[model samples]
Target: MSSHYGQFCPVAKAMELLDERWTLLVVRELMMGSRHFNALRRGVPRMSPALLSKRLQTLVRAGVVERWDDGNRVTYQLTEAGKELEPIVEALGRWGTRWIPELGDEDLDPHLLLWGMHRNVDLEAVPDGRTVIRFLFPDVPAPSRRWWLVISADGVDICDEDPGFPERVGVEGSLRTLIRIWRGDLDWAAALRSGTLTLDGTAQAQRALPRWLKLSPLAGTPRPYAAAG
Candidate 1:
């Protein structure tokens, strides 16, 4: 733990623990139901594994997180105190989506985006069958350009490896456009009409995509303040 504020107050006390770099984001991931260490890293990919381990240990000591060992893998979960931070995390995301300045190239990451979409996609909206959709981001690194979403009644699997299965839909677009679409900054119809996003493969897959993709939960939050400079 870092040095104390040398004073006693609720806000200051909380900040002493949660305000550290990556601390709140770790909490945010835990609140978002990330149970595995690798899963948490997806939400904050730039954070080093060593630093993340340290943060997890710090949070554990702070009684904000709990670890469970099942003989196979050790999973982490937020404790009661950690669960209390859901509103805080939600508020932060809502605020960022509303007031944060316009999107930039640096803000788009295909790996993280695919990881988030894997969890946020509306599985029920997809037709009842094995659906494979390949997303191609032309501007990203070649290795990271292609992402495959294999969705079935069981669950969704995101991978860079080709599953060899016939793709039901192929989406070719830049990462920025996809991010904008996901953030609700750009509408699906507009992207399609503008040709920034291309839809191919089966007709059903293209039709189901709009309904299957449910944007960030905070996407609907309204911005009451002016955009940041």
Candidate 2:
């Protein structure tokens, strides 16, 4: 089969560099600030190490990615040109969130959802101390209406029961609304106004919730998307 995407337009050329099965996804994972090879591999669980290495090499060859030796280990990162592809990745995320089928009733994988949401969150904004955020999914599509999420300097913590901590905040809403808020599709103010979501806790903590999870702007690099073979 011929893989000619035309030879003139820059966009087509760029797509030729990317637009592969798992290539774009690798780029997406890197956009979140992963560098080490193992870290990258862990980020995209569906991708194999062999394929990831090949994709990284392809990207490096195209100048969209740079592989560096950091004393004891090697790492990969997007180049100036590669950073420009952030918008494309963001667009792809939005599309996936909107159209991808729900993971369905039996307790949505909190970690995966949190991983997806982590892309938008500002870790620096989270409180310096411990905090618990409970997600109450009224229309959870399951029998339960409660799930617990703890956030701290370490990262997100998921649990079936509240940890009985003093810094707990309750968010009441449907699973869809929770997902929307997490994805940054709906801002806190709007979600509150529409009554799709509600929060209960210290004003400072409540206010910080949105800022902590806001999406970082995609203002770097231009990379090609390639699929893992």
Candidate 3:
């Protein structure tokens, strides 16, 4: 109400609630199947805990989110009204992919990239037993440069520190290059051929790695440049 534009337009009324910073991002996380509070934080890592809590409370008040407290753990889920925004969020992703093809240096986040990749692990495509893949971003600073993805029948887990498991594969590349590959802005084979990306592991692991970790949801969005070509 306080952020309202005082207009009777439906769009204006919707913007009154949805235009707040981090509001739709919270919804986006929910749409992506992040149910717990900490899991939501991982989706928007840069947002402060206090701000996230506030936003969650606001969403609860708006009836867009339902908070369940079973006394043991509290989980957040989108109400029917909130679930309706999925198409909007997806459309925004596709629009950005096609129009905003270039990324600024500040937009490249290794943490977020790794988190997304972890979520996109194709369980059926990966090996039957536990498989560990280490990703090295040499361009990043220490403590943040190395990451590991441990995948199994249970699920996928990402670790910044060494998980102490024997790594099945190692991928070394610049952060930008890897992000570009994940976003479909660049090709995996092209990056490898240009030496921008390298895989050091068993022949089979290297061959199946790309299939094992499916790229971003919007990666397949056709770009304008490519369409013109």
Candidate 4:
């Protein structure tokens, strides 16, 4: 494989190392700072454990990741070279946010939606010293209606509700609208302007909400791969 890629170019060699179907996604999940096997599985819900393990091994062999055994447990992290791929991963995320088709109701998984939002949110814009934000999912079914989002300094968090925080942002909308906003299909500003999203927090927190949720590419442009399976 390396010889086949050697004939092409450096870019091709890089792609040869990273372009396997689930390899880039595995890198993306690690970029979000998830270090555990189950966390990486949650980040890419559809990936099979066998496939993820294979991709991780491939990455390790390619020197793009380093595996560690901390006494009794194992964890995976990006090597320095792998960390350099952050910009490339972010660019792909920006492209996907702009071009992926809107998911149908049956296709809406709140965890996946939140993961997508987690990828796009500006971590620096989050209020300093605050480690968590509550997401009130009024539209989510009973027993899991509220999400206590915990953000580390890195802006990544475990999406499962944390029992320790107060509700911060009260978003009132259907699951569909929530999906739209999370997927970058709906503009947070326009949603606020239209009274579709109601935010309640301190003035600074309220001000930070829209900026934190702002989308880069304006919405409504049709995705070229709308029908991609």
Candidate 5:
């Protein structure tokens, strides 16, 4: 059966392509500068690699993505048509933030949270030289419970296993609390005051944590209920 709407309406035609599961998300990852397949995988951690590859091929066929082969490494990038979807994607995000703020337990993923946080790190605000930040989500099980972000002049690298760095800052909190903070459902000061989150390490490290780690851009979108307050 064909997925086409068999109509001339532009919206229907677009939905025939974009409405496929994980399709726009692939586009979202591309828009966020994930050029490599592995990087895109991080953005959609729950997606199977085979499914991801299938979506990429679909987008490439639609002329929204371009796959580049430099012999040694292959990378996927958004074509000009894909780039045009940036504002549309961002608008959908903002609308979702404003109107649909509820997140189910299944919606929370520690790996994804770290991926977004690591990507948006404010390198300028973080201290120079090697800075390792450890994240502990005790509520999560096993290997996924612990994580580290090693930042340096070289950039940020996330590790599920200990990087064995001697000096490190610590962030410990329930997964939900941290996700809330990241999504702007809860603020840092409020979480700290309520004892939902904690930061450890040098006083400087504690002070710099919020400054250097940027939250989701949609995190600040004004909600209707918030505006009334």
Candidate 6:
């Protein structure tokens, strides 16, 4: 894990521990309070299980993570040293949100998108009664292509399996389109006009979508973007 920078600086020393692939992301998940192994994997889905395990062990060795047992299952938690990294992780996310130029096809992941949505939905806009919104993403794999977001005054439930509730509205589109929509890179009206995004359901539900759907936290933040040629 040590990549020598050939410098005697503290920054270089820090980089050696933090620069490993998936290391910071694992930290991000931990900082976000994902304690179990499965939750961490969901947060960083593309990382191999073997590698995630290795990364966690490395962090523990570096005094950033601690492994413990609750007498039922093993758990991992961040040490004070790792907790100290919260601001750095957040700054990196904000910086990337503001400066990352473009997104590639490989970057579109339904699991991650839904996970983010589950964590960020604006409950205040939820319908007074039980409301179901389904999404169809043709570009995602069959198992994850369809998603149901069931929300009520009580709470929001995001499900990969069919919740079987009568949906009030449905959104059908490519996975990338949905990702861009959430990221605020595409205008909802323009998307509908272009037929890239389609809405189905009661006129009332259709009309309420734009206002009811709360997007990414960084969606409104102005960023320097680079267009693809």
Top candidate (lDDT): 3
- Per-residue lDDT of model 4, residues 61-160, tens digit only: 8888999996777899999989999889887776775565656667767677666666666777765655455666676786656665565575566456
Report the poorest 10 consecutive residues by lDDT, candidate 4: 220-229
Best by TM-score: 3
- Sort every candidate by TM-score, greatest first: 3, 5, 1, 6, 4, 2
Cα lDDT tens digits for candidate 1, 110-162: 98888778888788788778888899999999889899999998898998989
Pitting candidate 2 against candidate 4, the one with the higher TM-score is 4
| Per-residue alpha-carbon lDDT of candidate 2 for residues 1-229, written as tens digits (9 for 90 to 100) | 1165977998787778787778888888788888989878756766789989989998898888999999999988999878988888888765655555344555344444555555555667776677676777777545346666667778766566667877556778877666645544555687788888888988887877776665424212122332111
lDDT of all the models against the reference? Answer: 0.85, 0.69, 0.91, 0.70, 0.88, 0.85
Clashing pairs in 1: none
| Model 5 misplaced stretches (Cα beyond 4 Å) | 227-229
What is the alpha-carbon lDDT for the whole of candidate 3?
0.91
How close to the true structure is residue 159 of candidate 5, measured as C-alpha lDDT?
93
Each model's TM-score? 0.93, 0.59, 0.96, 0.64, 0.96, 0.85
Error of 3 at 152 (Å): 1.3
lDDT of 1 at 124: 78
Q: What is the lDDT of residue 227 in candidate 2?
A: 12
For model 5, what is the alpha-carbon lDDT of residue 67?
Answer: 95
How many pairs of residues collide in each model? 0, 20, 0, 0, 0, 0
Candidate 5 lDDT at 213 equals 87
Q: In model 6, what lDDT does residue 202 have?
A: 91
| Local accuracy of candidate 5 as per-residue lDDT tens digits, 113-148 | 999999889999987789899999989988699999
Report the C-alpha lDDT of model 6 over 1-229, residue by residue, as the tens digit.
7678989999998999999999999998888678899889989999999999999999999999999886887788999999999889888877887888478988999888877777666677767888898999987789888998888877777798889889999999998887888887787887888888899999888988877777877677676764221
Rank list by lDDT: 3, 5, 1, 6, 4, 2
